[model samples]
Target: MEGLSWSASGRDIVRDVDLEVRPGETLGLIGPNGSGKSSLLRCLAGIRPASAGAVRYDGQDIRGWSARRIARHTAFVEQATEAETDLRLGDVVALGRMPFRGRWRGPDRTDREVVDAALARLGLTGLRNRAWRTLSGGERQRAHIARALAQRPRCILLDEPTNHLDVRHQYELMDLLAGTDRTVLVALHDLSLAARYCDRLVLMHRGSLVASGPPGTVLTPGRLRGVFGIDAETGHDRLGNLTVACRGVARDPA
Candidate 1:
């Protein structure tokens, strides 16, 4: 996205953000709540129209593309999505195949295969027949991810995907994203997880781009204090991963 900006009720939620997510890389968007991370993701995915700026895919402006055409290239998983109907888990995930299906056609054999593979990819094959509403929060998250995977998009945009997941699931999800060959942009609140799993990090603050770089360079002690209002000690962990330990909230000098 180039010079991206979004506004609501005359107030800017996302301001003049220029970002380029590299191909085949996992890029983490980290910021405090309401810092416009989600808004940026929406603009990047072409879900929410940008107030000012252009979102380009493969060197062409995406604004000229149709919605379904955009869907074919980019998959987006929202922060919170729920299936209110009587849809089964598999059916919910099958929604991802809509972009690939023709207007008059239904799920063909290949569509079914893709859906099944997505379920298997997220370890949801065992629960494919379960009611969508009956699943736990983490399960719901996984289902959304599987749906994105089924889309077979070149770029995937996820907003706070780790919500409601346990510690193990969180790590597993990050690992999966990091290992994938597709370009991925994931919004996250956990600093250490982003630092450890993401090839690069983009930190947002107050509707502006605060910092963007590799984990080791962006996730620093002074940045932690200024950006997060916490005093943290940052260092590499035993396995050479970036680790951060927060001491406490920073106290302003008189």
Candidate 2:
């Protein structure tokens, strides 16, 4: 995205932000609540039209592209999703194939196979027949991810996907996302998870880009204290991965 800006309700939600994600790279978008992460993701996904600037995929501008055409190349998973109808899990996953299917046609063998693979990948195979309203919060999140994966898109943008998940499932989902060959732009609140899994990190603040670089550079103690209002210590864990241990809330220097 170049000079991307989005506004709603007479206020700018995303400023003139400039960003790019390399092919097959995992880029983590991190910031406190109300930092415009969600809005930015929506703009990037073409779910919301930017008030200004452009969004391009494979160097082709997507401003005038159809929704189905965009969905063919990218999949977006929101922070919270509610199923309007009581669709089965398998059926929900199958929705990802919609962009690829003809308007008058139903899912084919390839569609079913892709859906099955997605369900299994997310450990939702046992719940494939379960009703949407009957599943727990975490299950719903996983199902949504399964739906995205079934799209078989080259890129995926997710907003705080680990919100409803347990610790194990959080790691599992992060592993799946980071391990995938597709380009990933994920919004996350977990600093440690972002540090561990993301190849690069983008820090947003008050609807603008604050910093962008490797986790080591972006999640510096000063940045954390300034942007997040937290006093924290950073170090490597036992496995030699970056870890952030927040001491407590930062107090005003007065």
lDDT per residue for candidate 1 within 1-254, as digits (tens), equals: 32222222114888888777678888899988888988888877777777777777876777767889989888999997655879988998999999998989999999999999999999999999999889999998999999999999888899999988999999999988888888889999988899999999999888888899999888888877788888889988789989989898889611
Model 1, runs deviating above 4 Å: 1-11
Instruction: State TM-scores per candidate.
Output: 0.93, 0.94
What C-alpha lDDT do the candidate models reach, one value each?
Answer: 0.85, 0.89
Please write out the lDDT profile of model 2 over residues 1-254, one tens digit for every residue. Answer: 32222222214788878877788889999999999999989888889887877787877778899999989889999997765678988898999999999989999999999999999999999999999889998999999999999999889999999998999999999999999999889999999999999999999988888999999999988999989999999999889899999999999521
Please report the TM-score between candidate 1 and the true structure: 0.93
Q: What is residue 179's positional error in candidate 1, in angstroms?
A: 1.0
Among all windows of 10 consecutive residues in model 1, the one with the lowest summed lDDT is 1-10
Off by over 4 Å in 2: 1-11
Best by lDDT: 2
Candidate 1 Cα RMSD after full superposition onto the native fold (Å): 3.0
